[model samples]
Target: MAGIRFSQLIDNFITTIERYGSTVLQPEISSSRPANIRVITSEQVTDCKIFLWTITPGGGGPGVRPESERRIQMTNISGMPLWPGVRTLLGGWSQEFGVYAFWDARRHTKFSFRSPSLQVDANTLETAGTTGIATQFRPTKEGEEVVVAVAPGSLLWYVQNGLPLHNSQDDAAFVVDLAAASPEEERNFLDSAQSEIESARRYDLVETMRAFRDASFRPAVLQAYSYKCAVCNCDLKLVDAAHIVPITHPTSTDEVTNGIALCRLHHGAYDNALLGVKSDCQIVINPNMTNRLHEIGLDSGLEEFKSRLPDVIRVPASIEARPTPDRLRLGLKLRGWPEEQIA
Candidate 1:
């Protein structure tokens, strides 16, 4: 089958990102060799650039080009030819790309790019390298692998009929420094990337995202709560980040305000709907659970659990990090609390 146009792929890429609620400000496409897609999130351009390359199916899994073919030919800032002795001002350059493969009959899947260091060819006035993409900007320990979903898409009709032609000519390399991006900008990028991945409906990727999300969420919530359980103030290293709104809910979010740190016992109770937290941060026990405590063999422990809980759950000193009242209410409602009691 004939390959999709490079322009069409770019359009699809932009469309996919925008579908996740990110705005791609005027993308500046270069009119010369070494295609560029410049996404400007702010008025002032920064020094960070992220180069992206697309990997398509090959005889041996997804194939990456040789370093020589992937090199970025140097260009002046004005989009003019580089003259001798004219140096480029680009800094903090990193390369990333998506690896796409056919998952099943209907969909295509992509995985996160590996982190690779860029090698500058001074004599040739070009830059390129072959390395793995990091899942995030943070320094990962040596030999540790962090895999997350990059994006996935439904196969086009023509692509479903046969192997789509692989065209390296369509690859557009661009760069952005996520470490320097504002929180909102970072969230936008994550949201878009996650949306793309989820669309594939692959079980492994879904589970991976869930685990990754919780792994990332735990530290943020634990720090906000001083590494202690909000209900009982247990400071042992047994605390976990429990989502106020259950993860299965459509409206659930990973925001700190939507999470609370709790020890294993309280976390289990909260998830089971036997324990609830009001909008005012008051700890409440379900009367139905208490009435039937003996039947569940928790009659003796239930009283002790109630005694240990504070009048109000310990909250973060930062108001922004505190649990949102609306989310708390919704959480309680989801846990089968009566509307009157939830308020």
Candidate 2:
């Protein structure tokens, strides 16, 4: 219960700023205990700070640097890691606030930092499920919190805090979302632990085709074969996520047609755009590079590769006309080739 209150207290402190509007100074812990324990348990907390600023900028402010056009200043600052919890708060509401330490009407600077303790609200103790510890990864109570690096899909910041310091300037960014810190933090942690795992998983079949030019050809081939790659025979390892689709293209998934089981070398050739597969499953070396077929000085370094493709075994009796064929054809067009070369 003491831990829960501690979490709740943090929420309330932020709320206090929203309601009455005051600079919040976290209490210094001469000594402390969990909210309900009522016993004094002493501890040490390394340095922790929270710098608040707007989410989306409005117009401009005075500065030697390029001022954000937002009515709010970039409040240029440095030395703060962007926190997810803080982002949630600003994204949710606090962003539009005209009340802040920078406002001329405010008496005290709206910023304060001190020791961090898990002392909950005296009444309703929070932070219950947490394990206490001050690991830079998590502000937990007792157990380990997995640490993770931000993913590419992850937004670095809606607005940044690495700005110049001034009474009116906003700077220093911190993790924004705290209420659900554990889950998100753990997600990041899992990513960190499984970085190699995800990378390996991404190397599955369809991507094998992507290594070649007109990357879509592999998918079209897979889709025609229902993702099985007739020549090499591969399938999605599990079902939750499927194998090859354009990284961000709208259409991609676990369908057999989307899978292609190219051998290791073929997969490499496809992704780097070194080789291209035809709509008819023929190999089309970049014409300008009289080198695709001669890399090893053997007129046949990769000549036998086409026959090794899954397409050789089945050739889709009726020739299903490779769905919407446009994407791959567009890719072909991107290479500036004429119909004769592709067909």
Candidate 3:
């Protein structure tokens, strides 16, 4: 715990799972001084739950070398629902293992949350424990879920788990926006979101919203695409935003459904093909692009992306939010070219 930090390990594990998509072929658990290890996965959030556990001595497994290291992993078995008193007790013992119970909303049960025991300032703990705790259990469907992310540094059990967690409201926050919220109510929402973020040490709500914005764009593009790449149908690390339009001009093709996000090298190679995502959201590779193949590392990826393009097309924004086909066309034509305005 003192050597490397548990949160660091957990964060690495989370990242691995996110990238590999559960059920890693085999993880390389290092036996370095800190007994470091890493497992990679490419799963999205909804793919699978990674349940980690230490091989316990009682289970005829290696015991944690009290002075050196401990083991923890993602799991499905949830710890008891923690109350303020419960959090305090657990917090004291958490250093040994950064642990908390994660509610797997999908299963309607705790997915198992654990951390290497992040020590909180007494003042901060007092505020965090009681402040964010909803007096009553809001229905699962209601807006009541905590997305916790550890700070990457500042003495964590592991450095990797340090990413900031942003808990987005499930519509209630926006509902308040729609309703005639009095100044008091508006102030409360902002203050509450702000307080939880500061005490928990997270980026502001705007940051969280930005993440959604980026993801929406990616999702929108892929919705019209196949799960695999549209060019080569290679579903590996090749499906990503190709920006039928460049990202240089955020106004033009940054939104979801605007451009397909291609993976690895296809994006860079796309411009050569005169491959344009029509303002109509159609894939339009110039007739000439048919010539360049292996030179761009897209012999397989490009072909795969082509046929699968229409399938993965993302849900475009509302008519009003969508970029006009003309701009999209102009944007692609000038992409990577001298930034010239459309005539």
lDDT of 3 by residue, 1-343 (tens): 2333435544555553334222333244433212223323221212222232331111124553332222233332344233331111111112332332222233322433453221122222222233221111123342354322122111121112212221333432342132233445545656555465443332343333333334335544554454345545556644665554554554543555356545444555555644555555555555445554555564665566566555223433455434456666666666532232222
Q: By TM-score, how accurate is candidate 1?
A: 0.45
- Each model's RMSD to truth, in Å? 19.3, 20.7, 14.7
* TM-score for each candidate, following the candidate numbering: 0.45, 0.27, 0.36
**Which is the better candidate, 1 or 3, if ranked by TM-score?**
1
Ranking by lDDT: 1, 3, 2
Q: What is the descending TM-score order?
A: 1, 3, 2
- Best model per TM-score: 1
Q: Which stretches of candidate 3 lie over 4 Å from their true place?
A: 1-27, 30-216, 261-265, 271-274, 279-324, 336-343
In angstroms, give how far residue 223 of model 2 lies from its true place: 10
Total clashing residue pairs per candidate? 10, 56, 76
lDDT (Cα) of model 1? 0.47
Please provide, for model 1 over 147-247, each residue's C-alpha lDDT reduced to its tens digit, 9 standing for 90 to 100.
11122221111121111111101111101133133445544544554454443322223333344344445567878998789988886555778999998
Backbone clashes counted, model 2: 56
- TM-score computed on alpha carbons, candidate 2: 0.27
